[model samples]
Target: MSLHTASCRCGAIRFEARAEPFYASYCHCEDCRRASGSPVAAFVGFYTRDARFIGEAPGTYGAAPVTRSFCRTCGAPLSYVDARLPDQIFMMLGAMDAPEKYPPTVHGYVSEALPFFHIADGLPQMETSTVPRPKEDGQ
Candidate 1:
């Protein structure tokens, strides 16, 4: 099982989660853009059963259907949990020690992507928030 540990900038909050991720993507949704104050937000998903919080629990805010958690000391957005996906936790890639280890395989919410921002990475791009399915056996 793969394991990942991530922390806020000030190290006031940390997270440890094991097992493979359910999904990983770069989200261009407006909500995520506003939350991260960036053109896009990269995130990783893992089953809540294999995750644990260390140090102090971060402060949180209601971001519509989910609660966005962040470090009060450094104000870095760490994780966001959506009730719609109750079994998983979505964490910001930047908070991880080696964000490069989790390369995003898809891009979501392209409809909301800023016109000036273009991603030429060739990954699958979805117009909205659609969970991608794994490739099956040969046709």
Candidate 2:
């Protein structure tokens, strides 16, 4: 099994995933843009069971349903977890050691995207989350 590694800017926090990601996408929501301090943010999603944090624990913020984590030392955003998808964790693409390996397949929250920052990638753009819901839930 191949391993994917990611770390914060100061290397105070790190992440490891032993399996391939389930999804990768660019987010244009205000929450994501604010957290990342960017016009748009990209993420790579993995099963929570397949990913883990190592070295130092990350600082977290947000309400119960959604939590965002960052490196306490460097203040670099690291991960985002939503209770709705308990099995998944989304890591910031920019924080990855090799971000080129996981290119975003879609653009999510297009309705909230900054008008000045157009998405010209030709990828599927959705007004809602691009994360595929489990078939069993039929959501």
Candidate 3:
């Protein structure tokens, strides 16, 4: 209902999201682990247009159709935008001012989740990679 603001660790990039995230998830894919240097990467997806970057544009790298933006100063992952999914943006959960407020609703790429990691009880789980489905022609 209310806007939430988030920023990179070095304060190089900042943004605001006008609504609560539609969904949150923890990704255990290898790419995520490599990028985040953690066992998993947590994200909160929002409507792309609802978010506005403040200050300098964060540096971005395209991984095919998807591009990830991060703070050039600190190398902290900030957000992710996929050309294939233009309507949404996934903000790195750690960047949030109140990270605890956006606990993951699901655990994705669970097949690759770390051997020692145990998913919590109630969150949904998906083994394969998942992306937002496109709307039907009629909307």
Candidate 4:
């Protein structure tokens, strides 16, 4: 897989990943919208082990199911990771050096999607969070 490099708007936070993306998607969930200040958010999923911060580490905020890391300088949203999806990290698609490299395959939390906003991309729309919570170890 080709290298994937991304950074915050102020270039304060940067990261590089070598692992192939598990998937790319757009999320219309309220939390995502609130965090992104956009109608929807696009991100590419990769395991945490496959990615790393460059020089400065961004500030992180943990809220229940997920934790988001962003640049303190430019306040650019960077990555979001959910505990339920261990080892997985989702990086904002726009932050990518080559944003076009990852084309979204799905639109998640479509039920929450704004009525005034819709994409004509023809990607699958999931009515809820597409990443199912992992089962217990003994279950």
Query: Poorest 10 consecutive residues of model 4 by lDDT?
Result: 130-139
Q: List candidate 3 stretches off by more than 4 Å.
A: 134-139
TM-score of 3: 0.89
lDDT of 1 at 91: 89
> Which tens-of-lDDT digit does each residue in 59-133 have in candidate 2?
999987789999999899998998879999999999999999999999999999999998688999899889855
Write candidate 3's Cα lDDT for 74-139 as tens digits: 888998887768889999999998999998878889999999988666878899656656555758
lDDT, model 4, position 21: 86
> Which residue runs does candidate 4 get wrong by more than 4 Å?
135-139
Decreasing TM-score order of the candidates = 2, 4, 1, 3
Write down the lDDT of every candidate, Cα atoms only. Answer: 0.88, 0.93, 0.85, 0.90
- What stretches of model 2 exceed 4 Å from their correct place? 132-139
TM-score of each: 0.90, 0.93, 0.89, 0.93
The lDDT of model 3 is 0.85
Candidate with the greatest TM-score versus the true structure? 2
What is the lDDT for 128 in model 4? 93
lDDT of 4 by residue, 1-139 (tens): 7688999998877899988888899999999999999999999998888889897889999786799989988899999989888789999999999999999999999999999998998888999977777666857
Comparison by lDDT, 3 against 4, better one: 4
